[model samples]
Target: MSSNDYPLTTFLADHSIRPIFRLPVFEDWLFWLADRTGIQALFKCAPAHYSYSPGTIRRCTRHGIHFELDISTYHGWMIYYRRSGNRRVSDLVNRGDTVMDVGANIGEVTLLCAQKTGPDGLVIAFEPNPATFAQLSKMLALNPGLNCVLVNQALGSMTGPVTMVQPDNRNPGTCTIASSTTPGKALSANIPLTTLDQYIEEHPISRLNLIKLDVEGYELNVLQGAEKTISRYRPVLVIELVDSHQKRHGHSAADIVKFVLQHDYRVTDFSGQTPFGIHDHFEDCSLDITCVPNECVSR
Candidate 1:
């Protein structure tokens, strides 16, 4: 109970951590952690304070790619941790290959794909959020060596202005074009929308293959709009399937898997090289999955 408590002082002296406890920086960090992660606030980090002025940059050490992030938000935190969700997409990319990165967020993964595809290859990256798009553009500018075409449009089933709802300022990557009635609304933006099929028909690439979709739960619509592209190219499909998010859009993971199967493609988890069938229970439908056309399974 006293300042000279034998056991406590001895333990601190032995470990030499008393200076750490005495530092105001440590106290400040504790307070900030309590505020940021809500360790003691009984909730997650507050999402309202996620926005910051544009042009802030963070370098991802793992992938050696410089990403522009608004550190005042959730994505900024992800950058702090160097959170790379699925690097497996890079494995599927070959030199001189053409790739479509739908829902490219700040283009971190897109950067990796660009690197893999090399200068001769084409990397079409799309980000609908204006603020996030600015960040992606900044990254592209920082790395002039990357041959990427940054598109400020939402990839959907139609070519028009589409409204994407952002739940909050915390996570810019969560924006989706699905209707609000099904999944509640957030701050909305009217973005240019184009189907992959239409875009390919108009601006034909030398070889259209290897498409990655991380468009929240709007993968269904993008796929529907890309019917012709898929039928014609049969590119490897890398997609994220969130069951709850799909339900919010009035669909299910089963529907997405069914769509892939209907196209004569077999499903597999992102990390798994073995192919899965529609009837096979995926066990985890919440992560990125690979759907390859049966014809290419042996290749």
Candidate 2:
């Protein structure tokens, strides 16, 4: 039969393509087939490097706010938007609290915190990589209504100059610049660093409700830099602790636990499918370690 004369159902059946109703249960199967067969090429595509202009715009969602962002940084944008559940961190977030996202990394968590906190709450995101910061800044400009403050600086134990390295990958901003006792990889550049205490002192912050630190291997120094802030604000701290990454910087998971515990905070490992109950013992080797103030334990 001629293409125009063929019945739609017959064509789809002959092509072995399932109808949309069956998609929900087998979406992954379809994606896998498409990847293997290059069937995705049949769809219209945008340039991979496309980016959104730096300006304000309204995009609707189930949440109450609309945000602006560059298309190139869409991955980061999605991470913030799709977060769900009453995770320990989410509890404090629902109360319209302030958040600090060190090593903001394209501002995904930063944007998530912004949306959760609403207009009254504040989100201070620190990203030092020039390219990532560029996209992050553009996103901030796009969402002018959110109470977000962007700082292009690295967080470390002390305020001083440090080498900020950029990897050769597409997301060059993932490069880490903190000092390494054992050499592992080389980075693109070095940049000056600052302490979180200095940042809060410079800005008028009333309270710190949450803090997320993911500085590649520099997580320990970032926590140390914010010791004063942790003591005063007692914000819930979520940090990434890859053993290999920490070892490069002469740190370990145990050391991190000691540091947070010394500051009167209780550490919890939530890397499992089910949340650990009060009686459960937390494992020390988790990649993501979340800490809450001892006083806030029963809350």
> Looking at candidate 1, what is the lDDT of residue 174?
82
For model 2 the local lDDT of residue 88 reads 38
lDDT of each: 0.74, 0.63
On TM-score, the leading prediction is 1
lDDT of 1 by residue, 1-299 (tens): 33244443344433345335334475356446545743332111222224334434345444767655565566665654334455668888999999999999988778889999998898999898887898889888878899999998888887888777876546788888857544435445568899998888888887866999988788898999999899898999999988877767777887888899999997888876666666765443577788888998776
- The TM-score measured for candidate 1 stands at 0.77
TM-score to native of every candidate shown: 0.77, 0.67
Candidate 2 stretches greater than 4 Å from native: 1-92, 178-190, 271-286
Question: lDDT value for candidate 1?
Answer: 0.74
What's the lDDT for residue 142 in model 1? 76
Give me the runs in candidate 1 sitting further than 4 Å from their true place.
1-61, 182-186, 280-284
